[model samples]
Target: MSQFALLGQRRFAPFFWTQALAAFNDNAFRCALLVLVAFQLGLDDHAAAIYTNLAPALFILPFFLFSASAGQLAEKIEKTRIIRWVKWFEIAAMVIAAVGFVMHHVSLLLVVLFMMGLHSTVFGPIKYAILPQALKSAELVGGNGLVEMGTQLAILLGMIVGTTTMGAAEIGPWLAACITIGVAVVGYLACRAIPAAPATAPELKFNPNTFGETARVIRITHADRAVWNAVLGISWFWFFGTVLIAQLPIYTRETLGGDNTVYTLVLTLFTIGSGIGALACEKLSGKRVEIGLVPLGAFGLTAFGVDLYFARHGVAPVRGLGWLGFLRGAGSWRIALDLMLIGAFAGLYVVPLFAFVQARAPREKLSRIIAGNNIMNAVLIVAAAGFGLGMGALGFSAAEIFFAAALLNILVAGYIFTLVPEFILHFFTWTLANTLYRVRADGLRHIPEEGPALLVCNHVSFVDPLLLMANLRRPARFVMYYRIFNIPLLKFLFKTAKAIPIAGQKEDPAVLQQAWDAVDAALADGELVCIFPEGALTRDGAIAPFRPGVEKILARRPVPVVPMALRGLWGSMWSRRDSALGRARLPRRFRARVELVVDAPVSPEHARAAALEARVRELRGDMA
Candidate 1:
């Protein structure tokens, strides 16, 4: 099903709207307040600057102070109940904001702003932690994509609505107040329809000491290296985003020489682009939590970011140009394209990392991990603010700052990828599979979502592992023939993937023995291991007899065995079909239609080698 179909489901739609409405109100209220301070109140430039600067700090402060406690609360209490309470809290804040808006009470409005921040702080952990419970494993990516797209669009609309309404002279603040309050009430109503999501760790102790619990929660988040890095990747996205967004107003005014309409236009472009990219993740990832897109996103951020600088580094000669006039100017389209693609890539970068954290973190500790992620995000946002301020102080142009951030992205991405080669490996695999074949995977749900499993597949070509790796939702260690494992160009991929290189007893006894030990160990540790039962690639379009290697491994470690078959790969690039016919292999079937058919896993005791070979043959059928 398309991700959009999720909008019709009770499990997802209500939560989606509740969160989207909250996002709308948050941005709406903030934008309205800024308009009041900057234009309506008649504040001097210095005073306006103080309120503008203090606003973000006050809003972000709750994340640092209460995220840990909020995470615990999410874990300790039923989530839907807390969500109801949070919505009511929002209504109260909006009520206060209503009076503040009419009375021109800046202090009261700021207090409401802080209260909204606190609302978000309390909701942060539940936002992510609840997904794993509400969604099927296959639905996680699509669900996250929907949430992301909704949030981006909601934020954009909120900003436009808030700014436009508040820009009116006399009735503006009243209008803003009514709208915010109405949205808050609607959000509360939407959240009421959210089905119950029981606490993951109801028995867990609730630590009231903020400092001690904060450190402890962070420690839990960092317990897994991969999970922690994913969190860091998320934080870096915030840092990059904060810098880019913080500069856009100045960039629009000074660099683009445009008025507020142009600013709105640019904001719309970025937001719409991000929403498109967010919605695209479900299709691009094949509904899996594919992190390969993260690198692709990083590359786009840098490439277009640098190109953006060269597109228009100098200030435009014309001043006070409206959006239309700006768009008609020289090199304007390029700048617009740069901004849009940057937002698009930002969407691709973040959605998967969020899904990855949700899928990877322990269920009991997931809320705390999300809380810790919030804390890190808050710190980075503050740092981004400082970086933007420091660059402005050093007299760097907005375009120059964009250039610097793009360049810095290369370093940050390289560092992160270096620390986790799996990201690069997945990128390579995902690229190869998507480029070489249009893969249709079926019966994949039969593979256990968690725990140990032995996958036995009919090996057809050299790229079989890559295809399977790309399609499998869960990571699996592949066992390949020793010679294929050592192929010069492919050696790094195999080694990084931790593929076990196995040899026949006659060829290399040590290698064969070592492979057996590794297979058993991997299964014992609750990992998935896939092996070719044929032991070598088929020379013709036929299955070889099943070897006893699989049976031997099962005897040692009796994990569930899944039989998988790859079809339409016999004549593909790396297969032996052409070589057997004494002809040069060519790209005859580039982007060939391929199928990966998996059968229900057989219990270890009944998973005989011959039966599995028979099952795989039936699955492959006459397709080859």
Candidate 2:
């Protein structure tokens, strides 16, 4: 089985069920209480509205109040132990929920909601931090995707169960109570299967004062711009979700003229879309934490959200239509479809931000940083609620609100792209190259993290430099021939990349001197400089003899030399041997797989052209 398959591994299954069960129980209890107050109990409309609003507030409140302390607990204790304790807390919360249901007490139910929030608050840091420990580095994206998909599915099922069961007179509350308790027990069992995840920061000092510690954690997040940016990205997702979910009841009742079923259908579609988008992350990202998808997701959100606004304008209010009836209604299905696609794109937009935070944050304080993120998310959600209410008060329709949010998403995404140019730049390059060809890279770890290094690869295809550029985390200055460097369409890219251009000694001595000086300067500044040591692309798909100039440059810098080989690029349309006159007759759809094999780094004293060539040949193996 593929490593990306969640069910194939013990490491992920436990945590997956644990998180899904928590989401299900939380929503089930909330929806059941809302149903009782709104329908069976015959509460006043104003009171019901207050209850509905307060339900979310109570649920989100603990994330702000207790997340800082929870972060501390997660950092100081083994995650498995913390998770077990949290599961017990869930069981207790469910029991309290059962009492609330039995007594028909609104106050008790509200209190239970708050308690569930607390349960989730304590689990938040552990939920994210545990993955980096339990999963392999490459599996992080896929694991996060599965967890997200499962959580959204759980939300959908919970809503369905809560709404359907609450209306039954004989077994409504009893069924809900049984489901809640059973799910909690199952969660506890799943927690038992989780392998031990030791605390990353056992020496962390715990503080009881929530406000002060919370402020301190927020400060730490702000100190790292990348982490804080990711936090903002996550918070924005919650903001969008809060608006979308909050408006569902209003849209279903006032706009669609439908009952509870329509509300549930809308929620289900949106959530299912999110699950699909989350699952797509693994395949789209090639199992890496690809931030490039964030921009693509942002684009889709704006496009579909705007389309959904227009779609909603065409939906007529329904009267007592079942699921199939609703699907057949004019524009109702289109609206639902748009909502689902918007949600899926939103998932695509957010999952990478989460992975980015986990991969990039200081491991010692990841929990606290995640706690800080929770605080921001809570604040943003509250802001979203306020924004929606304000918009409604100002006579804006739900469709208009969506339009405004979608437009605002464009501006916000633009600002973030500006702050992190790499996000947009990398996204552009990665999308283009990945769509055009299948790229396989090996021995990428040979690239040193914090030193000057020389990378020598056999040039094959026109895009070889770009393939290497995209996969390697470090920025490299490629030394290219003058003609290729000045290629009409690629010159801007080369200039932006600061590629060095050289000519032969007899052709242009001045250009050659400038190239040498640029290479020396880049190495002195601790940059990795790459060159096709074969001098030019091979004419017949064979590795050319190693050029001696690379040795001379390495001798001056005395840095490590990394040998890399590019495979399966020989037959590409962009290969040097491709006939220019016959280019129009080339195969229309070339789907070749290319691999970049990086051999172990060799020190200047130990490496020569012959040694480097031999190592490259070995890494290439059959392809060579």
Candidate 3:
């Protein structure tokens, strides 16, 4: 089903709107406050800047102070109930904001700003933790993409609506306040329909001390190295984006030489571009939590960020230019493109990381982990602010900062990639599968979400392992013939993947025994393992008799055995058909349609070599 289809489901649709409206209201209130400070409060430039900047800091402060407690609340209470409470809190906050708007009470409004921040801080963990319960594993990427897109669009429109309504001459402040309050009310109604999300850890202890809880929760997240790095990756995106957003006003005036309208236009490009990129993730990732795109996103972020600096540096002067005038000016389109692409890449960089956190973090502690991520994000955001200030203090222009920030991304990404080679390996496998074959996986859901399983497939080509690796959601260790395992270019890959290399018992008993030991150990530790029952690539485009190797392994360590068949690969480049010297050769099918049909897993007792071979044959059905 299309990712947009989620908009119609009661379980998801209501929650999506509730979340989207929350974002809309948050931005609306924030923009309204900034507008009041800027044009109506009678403050000097220095004073206006202080309020403008301080507002965001106040909004973000709750994330650091209250996130840990909020996460505990989410884990201890039903998510829908908390969402309702949060929505009600938003309504109360907006009501106070209305009074502030009328009296121009900066202090009252600042208090309301902090309250709104508190509302978000409390809702943060509930919002993310509920998705895994609500959506299937396959729906996660699509679901997250939709949420991310909605948030970006909401932010863009909220800023426009709030600022515009507040600044209007005849119906100022009052109308904006009404809209914000109305949105909050509607958001509360939306929360009422969010299907009850059960508390993941109802028995867990609660810590009222935010500081202690914060450190403990952060430790929980950091305990998993992969997840912690993913959190850092997310934090880095915020830092990168925070810097760009902070510089937009200055970039408009000094770099683009444009007025307020041009500034709005540029921000709109970025927001819309991010939405598009987010919506595209489901299709690009094939509905999986594909982290390969993370690297691709990092590449785009650095590439376009640097390009934006150059685009700004060579910008043609367009004094006092409005939106239309800026668009018509030289180098303007390039600048717009750079901003949009950068935002697009930011979406790419973040969606999967969010999904990975949801899927990987322990269910009981997922909310606390999300809270920890929020803390990290807030820290990075503050660091970004400091970086911006330091750059400005050092006399660096906005464009120069952009250039330097882009360069810094390379080092950060390199470090993250070094910490997580799975991301790069996934990219290679994902790209190779998509490029070389139009691959379809049938019955992928048969693979257990978490457990040991022995996969027995009809081996057709040298790249069958790669195909299976790419298609399977869980990683599986493959046992391969030593020659294919030791192929010069593939040796590093085989070793890195921890593929077991084996020789016949008569030739090398030591290698054979080690391979058996490794397979048993992997299964003991609850890992998936795959072996071709045929034992070697088919010399002809026909099925080979099943070997007893699978039977031997099953006898030693019994596990559920899944029978898989690879069809339509007989004519592919990796296949031995019509080849000289039995080497892989290219075929007309550059992107040949290949199907890996996985049958339902049978218990170990029922998965004898003869039975599995018969099952695979039936599935393959004379595809050759």
Candidate 2 backbone collisions, by pair: 256-317
Instruction: Report the CA-based lDDT of candidate 3 relative to the real structure.
Output: 0.90
Q: Cα lDDT of all candidates, in order? A: 0.93, 0.84, 0.90
Report residue 151 deviation for candidate 2 (angstroms): 0.6
Evaluate model 1: give its TM-score: 0.98
Residue-wise C-alpha lDDT for candidate 2, range 313-376, written one tens digit per residue? 5345456666677777777677887989998998899998898888878787899899999999
Q: Candidate 1 lDDT, tens digit per residue, 320-398?
A: 9999999999899999999999999998989989999999998988999999999999999999999999999999999
Off by over 4 Å in 1: 581-584
Give candidate 3 misplaced runs (Cα > 4 Å): 314-316, 486-489, 581-583
Query: Candidate 1: lDDT over CA atoms?
Result: 0.93
Number of clashes recorded per candidate:
0, 1, 0
Highest-scoring model, lDDT? 1
C-alpha RMSD in Å of predicted model 3 compared with the true structure? 1.7
Better of 2 and 3 by lDDT: 3
Work out the TM-score per prediction. 0.98, 0.87, 0.97
Q: How many Å off is the CA of 621 in candidate 1? A: 0.8
Best by TM-score: 1
